[model samples]
Target: MWGPSFSLRDRDRMLEGEWHTIRLASSKKEKVEEEGSMRVFMEHMKALEDKSIGFKFHTIANEECVDHYVVADETETGEYSVEYDGHNKFTLFDADPGAYAIFDLTNFKDGKSFNLVALYAREPDVSQEIKNKFEELREKHGIPKENMVDLTQAVGLIPERVLVPTLQIPVATLEKEETPDPPVLSGDFSPGLQHHPFLSTHHPATSSHI
Candidate 1:
């Protein structure tokens, strides 16, 4: 099936974030509808959308809106080879992550349209990391953990040269739970804040931010 591909354009870095665009590339192969492959790509993006909007507000807020990431177009390729069993197995693939660019279309109260930071393979090392201690903290504090690590890595397994549509996530109807903080014992001093440095501050604040 036809899909979309994106070419990364320019991006700007901010102290807090960045913005970039993936230029609309070409379309996928014409003869086959690789539904399984396309679905795999879609699921990967949906996972990202989920994490990006997981934050809770301190006070009551307006209805949460979703960020828009769409597929402008896509391109794909495939090949088949004879196996030792005297049968041919065909493998299909795509190169584009999406057509045009994936972006958040929300208009903020400030009247600015949502700006997106585009990341590409050739872009400088714009990636970040988080420490295991953050996971430890999540476990210790009884905070529900997100399986983002597994999800993000899974997206890479999708072959290239195809532009899957940008994944969409609705404003999740979050159950507001007043999670009480665990008791902090003042007397359990360990001389210094040994665990603070390894607190994994680099963890993604939201999935979209990744």
Candidate 2:
């Protein structure tokens, strides 16, 4: 992502609906993890009066859904920001409209930080051309080819974009558990990501959420 590669050529056709985490890589990842089912729903919102878009990341692990969000504004073009981590930078650099999106997240928490680039696709997989583009962007970020990992490898899953009901259970009412819920951004932030962000989403200050 460079010089603001976010496209507004066709807003709805490109950015709306559900997407899957195809490939994810980081400047620190040296190995790949075993595959499993990972579900994350990126709810695209029009809550702001301006042409800004809100992205809320949530998951259903053991039937627990939390609330957290970040807004990205665009009159004709735009970028993004993370609300959780005070020392983090979120950027949406290049996107192929509805086809795919490439974003880089630099998460800094507890004075530790790592750069990550993710490829989100409308479907479960990406084309070879798109993969090349992803690698190109990561390489530009000083991330080598060895750092990349196919999160969707050998994992066959494709879910349609369906309307999910909002979290009606208040935070206070929801029961707390030992394991951290996905993407709340309230946990520890450590180096060397252990979980695929698609499985356990993270923002900042959290041990593992992307």
Tens-digit lDDT string for candidate 2 (87-168): 4465666776567887777667677767778788777788899888888878888987777777555332222221123313
lDDT per model, in order? 0.22, 0.55
Best candidate according to lDDT: 2
Weakest 10 consecutive residues of candidate 2 by summed lDDT: 155-164
Best-matching candidate per TM-score: 2
lDDT (Cα, tens digit) per residue for candidate 1, span 104-161: 1111223322211111212212233222322332343343333112223322222232
Q: TM per model?
A: 0.17, 0.53
User: Model 1, which residues run further than 4 Å from truth?
Assistant: 1-15, 19-129, 143-149, 154-210
Clashes of 1: 29
Global Cα RMSD, each model: 22.3, 14.7
* Local error of candidate 1 at residue 208 (angstroms): 15
